[model samples]
Target: MTAATSVVAGETLPSSMRASVLTGALKISMDERAVPTPALHQVLVHVSKVGVCGSDIHYYREGRVGPFVVDAPLVLGHELSGRIVAVGEGVDTSRIGERVAVEPQKPCRLCSQCKAGRYNLCPFMEFYATPPIDGAFCEYVVIESDFAHAVPDAVSDEAAALIEPLSVGIAASRKARIVPGSRVLIAGAGPIGVIATQAARAFGAAEVIVSDPVAERRAMAMRFGATSTIDPMTEDSRPLKVDAFVDACGIPRAIVSGLESLRGAGVAVLVGTGFDEVSMPIPTIMNNELVVTSVFRYTDTWPLGAHLVASGQVDLDSLVTSRFDLDTVEDALNADKNPDNLKTIVEAK
Candidate 1:
């Protein structure tokens, strides 16, 4: 039977919904799809807002990001927030009608990584918008109840959707071991870099220096808690000393420069997705005792992300440069082409 023919009990909801499907590179078709029914321990969410991410754009422009390729039709959107409309068995009915921010990852809870609270490293993980797994560029989607984190009234729908990226920033900050009175140097002023600045400050970093090529983004970073800004295009030769370096820009030169800028025993946390491999100064790393690490996806960061947004410690609305609807998801994914644009949101509801 079709999904429309088999409806979940309780809610009088439509069986079919509109979805923006990525048929191939640079091609998106608006297709009607069945509104999915929540399975056991899952919740049916009426997707409201989805934030456009760089990975989504990669999948759109190249049909691939690293090894994950889009050979079949796909739906591309992961940073999303919505309202719970229905609940499956094992979920409390009271959860219905709650506003929530989705974590967008389903990891095998039985894995060793999951047992250690590092589910982001679960070997058999399914992430939204990553080729095979369909994402939230549709009217309704179902996610595990635990991954659907409820947001406070103070967090707007757009902010709730953006909590996903904020979690990324939080994860990077945690990995960098940022502490009160620490100094942090963040390369790149993109959405993640800007958010990382806020996360660092919230984590008690005394100073956050942001380096970027764009003047507008550098200025924007200042408003988002950056103590100072640098134009890497002109100031790439300058040296800096800091407790931690967060590379939000995938550029190789920036990574090398950031490594050079670190003080002895400093930590470097790489958050950006660059090429598969890049050369690094091994001798410098050893001599300085600089700890280097990278983040795949966030692990157990949704609650802190939401709390930061609700408490006004982080301002997400300021980063929203444009808005689009599900029908215009193509435009939303390409919004970043405009250098002035910081972040774009696609409304599915």
Candidate 2:
């Protein structure tokens, strides 16, 4: 219930809306904020659901992720689904009332990276939930109209929100060049690992092996698409002779082992966040002529991600294990602490 005025999408616009804000480490509070208006080429969306990401939990537990600090009352949520209620100048009015998955990133179009179709590397990117940028843990959010990717009726709101993470998996798969009959090694059975496994399969990998210390996560990986699972504690990975290695777990030991597991000329895609600097086995990488890369954020991925979910190539809804509303966002942020929980979502309504 908020003050209503302009009507769009068969619903009145609100003068103000509720937002879950993070004031400091482990501190969240509900705050009333004025609804924002869309700028040129932007769209105002009535937020429906927001997926709680590992990075969100990182910001919740710590005041910052690396250099991005929470210095003010910052709204925290990036993976989200919503309905477009209003369009800014230069946007088509027909977009209103369309269900969409927000890409949550606005990179400067003038940068060299953006010009080269690698906007994820744009230094001027304004990604949601990052410091100085308010995210979508609110009733309404304004994003570039192009970033508000419409979804098919077959895609649920929860699945739409999950497109964000699935895009990361796609980015990782592309980086590793997972191809037909490719044997892939994925370290970690976390959400990223599970999604990466599916992405690898979709990209035509014949053998997908996931390594995790947790038994349940390993099972979860198998359920999704992993051809096999490895208990990093007891099992060895080098024998797999994988063509590519994707490290979704940032653990140093796992990374070292994953690198060693790769066959000669294999590619290693590092998708997990870890210490700023870590020593690597340079000799092995040099001798094998292996290529190593990292994913910063995804670019030009939402459309394909939505298509994969709609076509049943990827399963996003099954990842959800918990749901909460704006008021209980604190509990949502803490959901990762539970071993049984795979993914948590927050309803803006």
Candidate 3:
């Protein structure tokens, strides 16, 4: 084997590999590209599974999400699980072959948010799959070693990929300060909402209610531990009984409806990303003295999420409604637009 082809026990090998490139809006092409070598604190990972996220589908269709516009070709995917194929110089080789769920956000540790242990809000974060930061929808990805958390053998690769989204739910639960016997209402029974339902239950919420326009998703939410499912299109003024609410739809309508369901002095946590400038019922929020907060990504929750899935406390497998190979990534993303499907995954083979 050539020196370039050979990899040291821990050090990253030579550059270049294959990846799915987003050449333009609604266009994806498979292309061979240079693999990245890991830096001093990084490791090269052989990606095994990537969860098809809503953001990925949005980027595939529009080539941009919010302010992050894609002017050049970029690979897209964030929820990922992989094995450590190689590590960087001065790094420990003991991690080689270890399975892990990668934390896609790389925050600057010196930032105020980082110091405050709220790294998810770090302004200088370079999150994977976001515009300008090519993500792990490829055969290999090199990331900081600390950002990858080791997964137990009990966690399947599918479940490992879900750790990313699960972490988001966990973070949201923490922000809401969920407690036993608290009535929690979750809007949008998508992956995040479904997972949040399960997380809220685990956190001791007495009753967990979910709302979604999609019949399939609302039904799936019940299977995943939601105490009840509310279809906003059909159910009116019914959600107003919950003590707390979580807005996962990113739609203005859902936000308004979820707030309407909250009791006085209740909390509402917004956990979804949509187009900018979503209007809310500010007067109602003021009248109820509701505490409104938003969570961006996650912070220090990967290990907890891993534990939840590995221990079988949260059934991550049920959330995966479909899977596709790398070659069929486009089709998989397209299928995600269908309301019938809950979560889609892409397997690297």
TM-score of 3: 0.94
Question: On residues 222-316, what C-alpha lDDT tens digit does candidate 2 reach at each position?
Answer: 99999999998999887777899999988888888988999999999999987777689999899999898888888889989999999999999
Determine which window of 10 residues in candidate 1 has minimal summed lDDT: 1-10
> What's each prediction's TM-score?
0.96, 0.97, 0.94
User: Candidate 2 at 32: error in angstroms?
Assistant: 0.5
On residues 61-131, what C-alpha lDDT tens digit does candidate 1 reach at each position?
99899999999999999999999888888888778888999999999999899999999999899999986
Superposed model 3: Cα runs more than 4 Å off: 1-15
Candidate 2 off by > 4 Å: 1-9
- By TM-score, the best candidate is 2
- Worst 10-residue lDDT window for candidate 2 reads 1-10
TM-score of model 1 vs. true structure? 0.96
Better of 1 and 2 by TM-score: 2
